[model samples]
Structures are given as structure tokens and as C-alpha cells.
Target: MPWIEVPDFQPRRPAQAKAQETRAWYSIKNAASEDEAEILLYDEIGGWLGVTADEFVAELGAITAPKIKVRISSPGGSVFDGIAIANALRSHPAQTTVQIDSLAASIASVIAMAGDRVVAAPNATLMVHDASGMCLGDAAEMQKMAEVLDLISNNIADVYAAKAGGTRDEWRAVMRNETWYLPEDALKAGLVDEVMSAKQAPAEDEPAQMRARFDPAAYGYRGPAEPERPKPGPPPARPEPAAEAPAPALVISVADALTETEVAALRELAQAHLDTAPLDPPATTDLDELADEQPDDWAASLAHLTTPAPWGQALEHLTQTPASSATDA
Candidate 1:
């Protein structure tokens, strides 16, 4: 096993570091029945407050259970430490079932591959990327660090290829691209045996309810792709309304003294008045008397007429002088 010692290396964001200050890296609980055991790995892989590779392996060895279930939700840390932990899980005599509770990212994702059967929650996520490390030394030392990182990356890629059915180079390409997988994608890629359906409940449902603690943005990932929305269609066409018939024009014969333009104007005014107000026989008789008595009353009577036929006859009668009166003029 090759190990690189880089003192004073801090490869975590300030917020992430602050959050993990009091949290345990992992927890093991042996079932009361003694046939099954469960381990929760819910923090960074290796840190000052985190479990070391040796400590994790020792605790794993103590479990006498025939079946061991490892539930993981980690952002990953310490490549060498994670590699050791993975190897320990792989070599365990018991049937090891690894379940991704929320996330398994970076080296933690590598550890997930050690299980005999890997299972992921419907909302769980997996991320794989090339191994990274910081080097503070001369040019020659930096070059050596770069080479070591490449070697580590290649080793991690080999583990993925072995589990997921692909060539080492093929997986290396995917890792370089920093591939992210939803539970379904992980199953399709052979990274997980099953994507645990929401309907399926475990013996203890507490772990199933655990929300995703790993933030992809904190680790430089943009998270899963958003679902595509359907485009809107064009609006429906409206029917045109039916046209109405025009009212018949009223014709009035005026005396020869009236000019053609004045007669036409009078015809228009009478037609407008008749269209608005149609007169009965009683109103028409009153209008005849009004025309003889008061000129103002005759003007007002034209506006009260309803029927066009009677109003036009009355208008023609009012405009014409009596034959006897015309001889006197």
C-alpha cells in the first residue's frame, strides 16, 4: 500500500469543517437478535474527529452478526483511509449490504462498491470524480504529488470499472467528467443492485426518513438535471358574428319650391326620427293638428313618430301647401 504524507493539508470548506466538529464519522449498532448489524457513515471519511481506517475495521470485525448493513451519507475524505476502509468491508466474512441513505460522493462512493449488494434510496445520489490532493514543496516534490494523485485516481477508476462493467479507461473518462447519478441511473450503470422504492419499508423506518445531508454545491457539483417542461400549444379560434339587415329608407315628396339638397336633408331627418320612434294612429292625428297650429309643436311631433309609413305620409302632407292656399301664394 502506498501512502503520501502531506502535513497541514485542509481539503474542506470552512462551513463543512465547522459542521463536522462535533459529529461522529460513523456509528455501528449490533442488532439485539445478533443476526444483523447496522453501521451509519454520515460524515467526512477521515478527519480529526472522524474514524480512522484501523478503528473502523476493528469495530467492523467485532460484529458477530451474519448480516451487516452499512448505510452511507458522506462527502468523502482521505483517499488512502477510504481505500483501506473499502478493502476491510470487501474482505468481511458476513454478507455486507451497503445502502446509500442520501449520498455517497468522491472516495465514499468507492467504499459503496465494496458491498455484496449495493442499494440506494429513491432520492439518494452518487458522485464520482478524479482524486485530488494539495502539495506544498519544491517543483520535484509537486511533480511527485501529481503522479501519486494520478495513481490513486487510476486505482479508484479500476474499482468502479470492476463493479460497473466497463474498461478502466472508460470509467476514468466518466470520473474526469465528474459524473452524478440519481438512484435509477446508479442501478442502470450497475453501481447499485436496487433503487429502493418509496413503497418498500425496512424493518426500522428511521433511516429511510433521513434527508440528504451532503450539499452538492459545497463540493463543486451542480446537482441533478432538472426535468424538461412541455411547451404550450396555440389558442383556439373564435366564430364570427352574423350581420343584421339594414332598415328600408323613407321616401317623402316635397313641393317644387324646395331645392333637391334641402329635400334630401329633410328625407334623412324624417328617416332617422321614424327609425327611433314609430307613431300610433292617435299620435299621428294629433301631429296633423300640431302642424297646423304651432310650428314648434310640429318640429317636436316629428321626433315622437314611431312607424315609418305613417310618419313619411304625415311629413309629405305637412311639407305640401293646400291647392287652394297655393293659388293665394
Candidate 2:
């Protein structure tokens, strides 16, 4: 009897371009705590410059931490790669926690379900839709592709049904409509276990900052709602000086005294007059003299220009010519 020797199998390394592309999309690092690790999926699932399933699984396998955290901000990519990554995470020994930092759309939303506990930031968004693909061939090939897409969509619907509280058919309907969920909505739907609110006061532009991290619109999502700009706050109260003489009352000029609406109305009236009334060189010269010589009186006279009658009277007084006289002349 003769025993034949078996050759050792060596896996082929990915092409340099492929390796660089995948490296751009994800990072796996040990957390500050020795027993925990973190993974960031900040790009699409699988494409040029996106994370690939094989690369992700290989890196994930290298981590020995008992607990793992996967932070996602992606518009999603290849569905098959996403499925593979999700399954790998689901089967891992470590207790996995998924955090949606900004967005998890399409297949990325599917990967989020692999976590034992899924959490989302207050402004984070999750989107789900029926699986889609492109096929170029004869009628048979097109039909086959359609079947494949339907099968993939069914599997995705099952994943949703398993995580959230609904039948696969119900989830499929929602997916067909291309549903998007905010953190709270996701919680209600059982897609996320928690919507984590900031314990401390967030930065003034926190929502805008979070929004900058991902653009759901690029992937055909409506994207997160625009962050409300913070209103202008009143100036801080000044401390009184010790035993000082009372200061003169602050004087507000006529310009400052006018409300914004009044100013706008006056400007509109002036613009209308300028547009319609013929320019009189002599009247304009006299008005300029009045404005320059008696500036205080000019301002005080213009203050009454908020009303139509007062505005006409003021304009007549400034030009020293009534509309009737000008028309007759």
C-alpha cells in the first residue's frame, strides 16, 4: 500500500488595487478596554474603494476580543458581500453591538441586524428596499435575474422579520415602498434596540456635523432632515461697577429706532417712487441739500415715512414741491 502526499493549499492574495480599495472603507482596531474591539464601516459594502466581505471577515477573525462594536455610516453596496459579512458577524463568538453613527441604507441595513444589540444615534437613519440588480442577456437570462432578485429580496425580508416584530410578507411590502426610519422610528419598528441620546450638551451644530458624515441623498434617499439653526441668544448680562456715577442713558439713533418691518416698507416705497417717478435734477439737488445741511431733521422727518400719507408728505416737504405743482409744471 502506498500513501500519496497532499500538497499544502495557499490562498491567493488579493490584487494590489483591490487590497487598497477595500482598505479605504473599513478599519478594525482594539478599543481602549482590552476586552473590546471596534470596527468602522464608513463606506459602501463592496466596490472600488469599498470594503469587501472577504477582507472584512478575515480582519474580524483576527480579533480575539470578547466583545465587538461595529459602527456604520454607509450608503450600502454589494448585497452578496453585505450578506456574507452579516452572516460572519452573526456567527462570531464575540458579543456584537451595532451602532448606526449616521446612515445605514440598503444592504448596510441588513448587516446591522447581525448585532446582538443594535443602537442608533438620535439623528441616524436606516433605509430598506427590495434587492435590485442589472442583467444583460436574452429573455431567459432576464427572467432568471428577476427570479434571483426576488429570492434575494425574500431573504432580506426574512432577516427583517426575524429582527423586528412582523411577518416576512409585511416587511417585504415595506421594503417595496423603500422605507426610511429615524432612530425613534427604528426603535418602534424593533429595527434598533435603543436610540442613544447625548448625555451631555451637544455642539451647537451637532446635527449638521452628523449630517456631514454621510449623504443619504447620493444614494437616492431623501436624506436626514435639515438641522435647525440655533437661534441667536441674548448678550450676557454685564456686572455693575462698584460705586460709580450713573451713566447717561444709551441713545438709539433713528435708524436703530425703526423696526425691521418698517425699514423694509420704507425701502420698498422709495424703490417704487424711484422706479416710476421721473427724476428731477433740480428737486434731487434741493433734497440732497436738505439731507446734508439738516441731517437730524432729515432723519426725524423720514421716521414718519412708515405710513403712505406721511411718506408722501415727507417727500413733498423734502423736495419743497407738491405732486400737483410738479404735474402742472
Candidate 3:
């Protein structure tokens, strides 16, 4: 009964330092601010598990790779944190390539700009808007906060201007409109260097990741009409063997989408603008200009100056063509 013998005592080896170098870390987290609430929230499932500026720098430094590829699919985060991360990437010795595999909105777009080459998936989206944050305290404090926000916006515009080869004022105007860009639009705007590889056919089986969804109205934004959610169905049966050789596949292009050559031309046009002229700050602030420029009501005032985006024109053309074609017939 007392024959139980214990194995020779062995101490566990101390964790080896830099034993395994990380090539990539999925930056699928939010850019949360450093605060008690944010920290606690990040700790919990409800909060976005974001990589802070310090953490991003540390990871980049720790990795010994000469080239790094960062994959981003974030809904933007803290502006300062994003900026810090961008600077870290920019200063790193390694050649960095950022792949926007999915969405890269708000400050995430700024971070994307830091890459030596930024590539976006055809379906990826990039959004830019004026810097905004909540404020508290008295009127004086509010005024101070507004001024700080304006400065921050200017700083962001400067970053975009440097990367996208546009004047700071032009970028700021785009920001004020809260613009969203597809891959082609991004390429044209110099937001992305190139579009990602071609799309693949739908797959029957693939691992699915949980996607977060929210009301657009909550963010003061509106998006395209949502497609109906598909119900889970039984997998399709295997097709019967064919007697004859399959006919050559017929490819049909969507009328609304851009062609590869067109996208390349847009990229060329964007590259040509690399020698952008610097802009002087206007004599008056943007707010002052807005007042002076828009004496009419909001709808009528913006009409004279607002030029419809190419994508909008494409959509309208696509939508009307079928009806007009039918009428002609």
C-alpha cells in the first residue's frame, strides 16, 4: 500500500525570452483610451481588446523580422493611440505593409497611411471625419476643448496631406464631409497604394468569425441598404458527372464597379499628384469660411459647391440604364 513512488522532482524551465518571434499580431481590437473605465471595459468582453501604442511599439521592436505585414480590421479607436502607432510603424527599420483585409475606418485609416504600401480589399472601406470627442465642465472648459479638437483635426489633416498628396485644406474639407471610400476610391484619393488580389468564388465551408453590428444612426452615419440575412441551409449535393466538356466560363461585369485598368489609371493619376502644392491657412478659420460661403439654407447652400462622387454617378447610371434600355426596346 505504501509502494507509491513519486517521480524525481524536476523544476520547470524558466520561460525563454524572445524564444519565439511573432511575425504578426491580429490588430482586430479597438483603440481604446487609457482610462479606468476603458481598461476595465477592455478586460471584459464588452470592451474592445485593443493594442495600445506602447504595446504596438514593444511588439514591433521585439520582432526581429526585416519585413512586417500588419492586418487591420478595426472600427477605429483612440485618435492619439492610432497616431502613436502610426508613428511607430513609420519609424521602424523594417519595411511595413498594411493590408486592410476588411474595414479601416476613422483613425484606423490614419494608421493605414503610415505603411510603406497600403493595400485594401475590394470590399474594404476607409472612412475619414473631423475629430470629435465628448466634453465636460464649464463654458470656458468647453471652449478650450473645442479649440483643442480643432488643433487635433488640423494635425490629422496634415498627416493625410503628407500621405495622400493633397493640400491640408482639401483633406480637411473631405474630413468635414465624413467621406467613405471603396478600394477604387481610396486608390484614386491616394489613401491606398493598391487594391488587394482578385475576389474568390463563394465557399461552401469556411470558419466564421463573429462580426459586431450596430445601428448607423448611433454614429450619425448611413450606409447602403443591408442585404437580407441568409438562413442556414443544408449543404448542396455534389453535381452529377458531366458527359461533355464544360463550356468556357462566361464572365459578366457589374455596371457599377470599376474595371482593373480604370483603377490602375486612377492610381496613376493619384501618383501624379505626389508633388502637391502646400496650402496656407486661410485668413479666417474654416468655421468663419462656412458662414461666409453659405449664406443660404443648408440644403441649397451646399448644392452649389458639392460635387457628386464618381461612385454615386456610377450607381445612378447603373440604376437608370435598365429602365431606359427597356423603354428604347
Candidate 4:
């Protein structure tokens, strides 16, 4: 006998982007497709998200305004650059707000937390992960780089811990273990705040999408699914092609090449020659012989051997000086 009103149930509008600590909101304008090989050439992850580290820091410092906005949608960048950006954010003069209009992942996640405020799109995503670097050098240098990486990881953990309102250990556990999070999940995990911008429906993910880096031909991750319980099978037998006398192509695996008795012997002989034979340095012995044929003085025929390097001064050192006035007593 009474009129009933229906309750409004529409979603609330997303908050307008507040000017962040840096005053200026910067975003990366160019990023290749996910299928392309990412070159950390500019040092800002796939150049996704928004501003590069250089631009971000320089702009952040120049902001006279109270708040700055960092518009991000990156797939992430080099861990080194990410840390540099993060360190900048951590020590910035003003508050920094990192806004993920799309995704901030891997090293980008580190850069995002360099903010006093972190927000994301309604359908955005974030992933936390350990730092990785390609190092090549002497064994000692490689080992030193490894230690440096471990230190970087800890420093990154400290930033995430501070921004997320979480402990360093808690952050490191998730990061070191490669935790990926949906927007809501990231918010729940304290990696970010509320999703700020609205978005269309999240893209349907393919199985191959996660393997963005692996070469499909070289590292086949997907094929016909293997049997749930793999059955024991004989090891793959490499094909033994019929030999031709003086084959046109010498293509062969090193293992197979060495397995040949004649090839092995030849390889050993070559190695022995390289190891045991004394290689003559560029010497004047031959020049001396040629000089003797020039019909000149025997002094001209003298062997032109290089003198040994001077070592007397470098091999030992001794120094003495008068005692100072105070010490002489």
C-alpha cells in the first residue's frame, strides 16, 4: 500500500587525478607492442608507463608546485634505471604520486613506489620481481657484480617496504619470488592504492602472453601438452648422416666432432702444438741474417732482440727519511 523507491547502484565515478608532488604529470608517449623485443635502450623498461628516469628526476626537481604526477603505463625497464628513479622518488623534495593508467610491472614497479602516493587504473596490473642483469667479464668481476646485484635487491626491497606500508622482508619475499598481481590484488597486497582511472574490460590473456621474452623456436614453452605423467622414453638419437669424403659442409656439433677418432687425434695434435711449441716473438734474428747479406759491417748483422723490461725499480722499494722533530726524541 506504499510507493517503494529503487536504490541507485551505479558505480562511483573515479576521482579526478590530483596534481602530484612533482607538479608535472609525465607519461611515455612511445612503447612497442608486447610482441616486440624490448630494448632497455632508454633505460625505462619497455618505455612504457610514462616518463623516463632522466626526465622524471629532472622534472621532479624543477617542480615548484606542491604535488607532482607521474603517469605510468610501463612494462618495466632495466633494474638499474628503475632503482635510480626509485631513489630519486624516495629522496625528492616534494611528494610524488605515481599513477598507473595501465600497467607497471617488473622494474617499473620499483619506480612506481618512488612515490608518496601510488594509484592505478580500475583494470590495471602490477608485478613485483627481483632485479636481473647480464654480466660478462672475468670471474672476479662477475662475482663482484653478483654481490652488487644482491645489494640492489635489498635497496629495492627497502623502497617497496616504505611505500607499501609493509616490512622489507614481506616485500622482498613477494618480489624475490616473482609475484604478479591484478590491480585489486596489488591494492590488497599494499603495493598500490585504489585504482584511480577507469578502464575498459581487461584483455583476455593468452597462455603465450606471459612468455614475452623467450624465443618460441629456441625455447618451446607450449606445444601439444605432454602427458600428465611423463613416460620414460629413450633419449633422442642424433641423426647419423652418411659421410662423404671431404664433405662440402663441416657442420657438426662440437660433441659429435670430437667423438670422431681421427678428428679427436687432429684436435689433440693442434692443442699440443699450441701448448708445447715455443712461439718466437718478433725477433731480429731473421733480420740479422738479412742484414749480413747486405754486404756491410758485422755490427749491422747483430741480432735485433728487444731488451727485457726494466724491473729493478719496480721489483723492490726502500725509503728512509729523517724522523720528525717530535718523534726524533
Full-model lDDT for every candidate: 0.79, 0.82, 0.64, 0.58
After superposing candidate 1, which stretches have Cα over 4 Å from the reference?
A: 1-23, 48-51, 201-329
Off by over 4 Å in 4: 1-56, 90-94, 197-329
Model 2, C-alpha of 318: deviation from truth (Å): 99
Write the residue-wise lDDT of candidate 3 on 1-329 in tens digits.
11111124323333342221111223322222111010001110101223235544675566555666667777776677677778878897867778787778778888888988888977888899988777667888788777877788889999889988978889889999999999999999988998966865544432231112334577877777799999989999999987997789978765237666556655654454443422444355677675676445434534533665444543454466777968867
Looking at model 1, the pairs that clash are 277-305, 277-306, 278-306, 278-307, 279-306, 279-307
Which of the two, 3 or 4, has more TM-score? 3
Best by TM-score: 2
> TM-score: which is higher, 1 or 4?
1
In candidate 2, the residue pairs with backbone N, CA or C atoms under 3 Å apart (3 or more residues apart, or in different chains) clash, namely none
Candidate 4 local lDDT, 1-329, one digit each (tens): 10011124323332232223112324322223322211111223423232234555564455454445666777775565567677876786655677776778877887777777777777777887776666667888778777877777787788778766777777778878888888888888787876664544545764355455455757655667866987799999999998878847767565553336545555655575466533654335586664555435334323212322222222222122345433544
List TM-scores for all candidates, in order.
0.55, 0.55, 0.47, 0.43
Q: In candidate 2, what are the lDDT values of residues 187-211, reduced to their tens digit?
A: 9999999888877577798678667
Report per-prediction Cα RMSD to one decimal: 25.4, 38.2, 54.8, 47.0
Pairwise lDDT winner, candidates 2 and 3: 2
Root mean square deviation (Cα) for candidate 4: 47.0
Candidate number that wins on TM-score, 1 or 2: 2
